[model samples]
Target: MKSILTMLGIAAALLAAWSARAAIYDAIQFGEPGSEKSHGLESDDSEVIRGGLDEPARILLPRAPASWQGGSVKFKLRVNPNRQNYVTLKLWGGDVNENLLILHADGRQVGYRSRGDIGLLDYGSPEPAVPGRFYYVTLPLPMSATYRRERVEFEIVSTGRIWEPGRTFEQYQKKMLTPSRGLYRFYVHDHSYFKPPAEDRQGARPEPVLPPQQPESFEALKERVNRELDRLLGPDGRFTNQMQLLMAAEAAGLEWSRACRNPEAVRRIVAGLDNCYLRWREDPSLASDDRSAVYPAWTGFGPAAEAVRLLHKDLGPYLDEELRGPDGQPVRRRKAWADMLEAGVRHLAASRSRHPKQSMIVDLNLYRNNRGLRLLDPSKGLPPEVVLGCLYESVGLEPWSGPLDGKGKPVLKSGGSDRLFTAKRLPKEFGYDGNDGELPALAAAIYQATRPEPGKPGDERILGVLREMIRARSFFRYPALNLAHNPVMRLETVIGWRDMQFPGDVTYVQRPESGASVLQAAAAVLEPYSTGIVQQMFGERQFFPSLDRQMEDREFRTTFGLLHVPEHYRLLTAQPASSSRLPMSEGQPDFVFSDEESGVLAVKYGSEILYASLYWRAPHAVNFLARIHHVTPVLERLATVRQEVEFQPSGRIFVRPGWTNSGVGAGGLNYPDNVRSIHAGETLPIARLPKTAGTGQENPLAGRGDFYKLLYGPYLFAMNASSREFTFTTPKNIVYKRLPDGGEIAGGTVLKVAPMSTVVLRRAR
Candidate 1:
């Protein structure tokens, strides 16, 4: 009877522990990549647990010594299956804070994550439905005393076709045995554990101090990097983003080999080169306005383009020394500029759909030589740059798909009038005759860099012209990217730009094995050919006030040219040849307001209306213009509204019927009172009120910005920037009773705030 029970337990352990790492039988040493020392700690009879038909219900993972710290528990799972089967795995941990336990099935199947604020083992997602092979799972168990007793559990279940009632034993054995090929490997290393004191279990001890590994000398580092690159990237020259970046690091290593003679020098050079190249290669320019595009140029410091020429020149010399050449010149081993660029283009082209917002083809031909709207109307066909430029422009901030105003001739503002269409005549019409000179310099620098000559002054010329030309652009007039295009590629060159705000954290990290993991750590990969950025950028659709609001605020009508015209303007990410500001008649304002005193008090912009009503405790404020005669559809006329209001005696005033009799003076009316009583009144009158609300004791008018729904959907929640955190609010029509707080208001048709940050009312399925 005791043997029967032991066998049953063993079978269960074998089934469940198929994918988990076997318990350590011998002491092992694992540390930094190259230097691992194994201390004699493993006992010959160390517990060996196998998962077969059934897995054990609990596991006590290895923990760091109470005094000696710095150890991690690494375990592997071995699953034997003939056909795909659904499965779920749970892990127990010491720390209350949720720790990530990685599960890899078929090298691609990733298990779901469970996170919490407290210490506990987490149950993960059900496994693959159709599993055909043995799978491996790796879990990291930190060596902390806080974790006393816990175990990992595996729940394997069927998902697809159910087994028939009758099946031969041999048939089932064949199905299961064919898939279970070999024993899975599990490794536990000391590197994963943080150091801790021997006795204390609750408190964390610092990790054992280890000296920083000094990098090899430039020559040695270069050789090692080359070897590593060869091991990772074979002859194909095609690699994942991770591989490509590591190759880039190798390129940096080569540069370091040439730039620095010492080991530390290589480190410094490579560190400085990391972020700039990867990001710049992704997006070359990030101009604020549509009138200019910037590209990092290697021209200025005493013929910098020569560096390219040098690479071309010495490349043959370097290769010839290592290998035989056909014509006595060195053989070219690395990919040339054209080949690499072509490969990049091909890769992006194949995956163009993945990056819809960015253009795969950077055809300067479509932009630089475009003569008329018919050829280059941004609204009609892709201008190439808009989709392409966003790949760079949206870094660290939200992506943008707005019009390509930054690439064309600067619409020099007159400053006299804000409306460019009216106050500023076309540059040609005004006979300015000055072409945007920045373009030629940019073009020249690119030319020189791509084709630098030995003993020629091309490099100096390119750098000088590009440096001066870029500095003259409008964005540079303000605090800007402080770009200094010098030939030297020296760090000092950027120090003087924009009060010396140098670029941030641009170092590259190279890991030989996993490409995606490393790239994910740095930044979300902006798929070069994907429209995802465009969709996210242009998705921020802004709705305007209803027609009634336009009728009320003459200034808005004139400023945006949305008055009587009844036209709606959708700001497209792609720039159109021309766009009208008129509001569409079909367009509806989100809200409508009216009062008994004033028939149609005023309409407000969506934001303006939301702002006025944010303090729900306060009455709504609706300020309106009285004189229809003063309103103008022309934007030029609207420009005078601000000035006229500033100089007027009362600025803007409202007179009521019982002004003198009811203690209501014949002056500006109560805007807030009008807004609140809008629905209460039977028939409201329309009157123009004073534009400037004086410093009176009662409700005064501040600009429209002061009032609005400061908390709106899609407004990112940040520790800073937002004071009122965004709590999911129930949608209208669908009834909701519960607030985010635990207390429930009602439940029959309640708003359920799902785990996903979206509002769900009773109507929501």
Candidate 2:
């Protein structure tokens, strides 16, 4: 019995030892050394008195044990007169990674800091120190697998000055110099042994949840587009409501007229213009008011003037001969149009007179001329000198001001609008106000008006504006992922006028590259067409090849006009060198040509060629064959060899094949001269082999009926066959008959054709 009792006592002792191992560490209270349960010595500078307002104090802690791994360390601190100060507690130990965690006074986790491969710790939010309040802070000192037990020392510090918003840096420095008393009490406790209040744990709030987005359908997209178009183009359209909207509406109308050549579209165009004119007439203030006297007249006059000019220039031919005026008297369309134009010019002249020292035509004024609309005559209203001065002032050039200095540069003027145009400042200062289409349209209009006039002094300033406008279009920075609207407006304006001027005369400030915006690429390729620019476009399209199709087809149909020409021209890169190609670098022959007979459109840059089929194809669905040339220095070779179809209202159907090396550089169908309508049963071979290609490229026909057909009207039909092996052959059952005046013929025999070729069937008078 004695032996058993001794064994039991031994077991009891072991249990007690284990319990002590799990026991919580003793708490350390700040006071005189040995006054309380102080486990370690205090810093020499720290005062050891019970509790009173005093300076910052520090306390050291006994070495932590290795068995404390996976557990946390915690402490409590109290500050008198809770002031907003940065309260920091730093703990360091022998050869251990430094890890810091911050928490709000309310115990909400905010952030964490780790150093030297130490793991992350949840640092709660840093809350302002409240006077006379105690905060419980928990530090999760995670021990690495390689951690060795060692002594640790921690110090508490609280120091800061009062700060307020809107204080200058100097004031902040001065305020920081003024000190405030910082009194704090520090206490340490074993983290695992103590449990914080439940409310403290619940202080953190989760981030707010967001609702899911509703998916849009094709019909919904179509409906939305229609609604927006109606809102923008209707008789009560918002175009007349504001100057910006008015300009955008005008550009949209112009595009609509070009894309959809239907009666309803033309009528809408005319109606929109009529509304603008009527609105101007109703508001006599727009015509008679002194624009310079208005607060923002400097910005307002240019757009107002541009609106009047476009209304007259674009709407004059389409308007009805006569319309009832406000007094109920019949007014001729031309008379009303001229009246509005005169009023706008008079307003500009008056504004110029009011701001003699200031340039009436600022960069903003030019931006307001989006379509590059020119004055009907520079001789009328504002003279060339005043207009030129304004133009020069807009670009920071005083060509007429004084003779050239030592460097042949115009002498700088101290007081003038010319100071406003700097390379660094101009881009941010000017350009489209927003994604609105007005500014580009306005710029285009100004270019059209001020295009270089030969032998005219000060006309070069117009080119300066043109160059600046291009720079703005290409290089103006935009917010990330944001797009500029109607980027091609200026390009279209320049292309429309290219034929009237010398090829080398017009120069762009920047050469467009592969990474440019889609609209930018469209504009660049057509600007004195280069195969390189077109090839670059093909390369760039890889990034957002379908973005245009998705956004443009659904939301902004205005892009239709901008893309129409580029889409119709198909480039065939598969052909040999003789077919034409464009170089990747600069130095190329700049030429743009449309061969109606061959149905081939081409642009050349040096030895490289960018050519496409002129026949119409669905712009959205066309595909190109991509070939990889190099990987280290990336290069691509894209090719397209497809057939397309177009229909005419006069009972003619055109089928054109893409250009290939086997045929003439360009080839298409030939029509019979002065021939009346063909009989419904008549089949005629329309494609004639060029003398150059001769009979060498001829092949037998498969005579297949597989073809894609489009109907524009009851009489007009178009069909395209994709098979290269198929050929056209006259059917024996159908009869060929001719009719007078090109009347519609019912039956026509299938025409014979070579493999991989196109032909057009038409009844012409």
Q: Which ten residues in a row have the lowest lDDT in candidate 1?
A: 635-644
Q: Estimate each model's TM-score.
A: 0.22, 0.31
> Which candidate gets the maximum lDDT versus the true structure?
2
Compose the digit string of candidate 2's lDDT tens values, residues 1-765: 333332332333223222222222223344433523344433422233222223222322212231101112233333211111112221110001111222222222211111100111211112111112222322222111002322233333211221222144333211212111221333222221122223211121112232232232234333444455465555565443234333343344333332133344335545544554576677757544433322344443455445445444445565457776666788775456456545544444334321212342333352333222234333234334445555555444542233223222334452333243333212111111112211323333334345333112324544455444443433221101102111110111101100111011101222222112233322322333323333333332321332233444532333322322222232322312231223222343444332222222233323333323322211111111000001011111111111223221122222213211011112222211211111112111223322343222321111112232211101111223333443333223333222112333334344443332333322231
| Runs off by more than 4 Å, candidate 2 | 1-267, 285-322, 327-332, 346-380, 399-417, 423-765
- Clash totals, every prediction: 82, 45
The TM-score between candidate 1 and the true structure equals 0.22
- Output the worst ten-in-a-row residue range by lDDT, candidate 2: 623-632
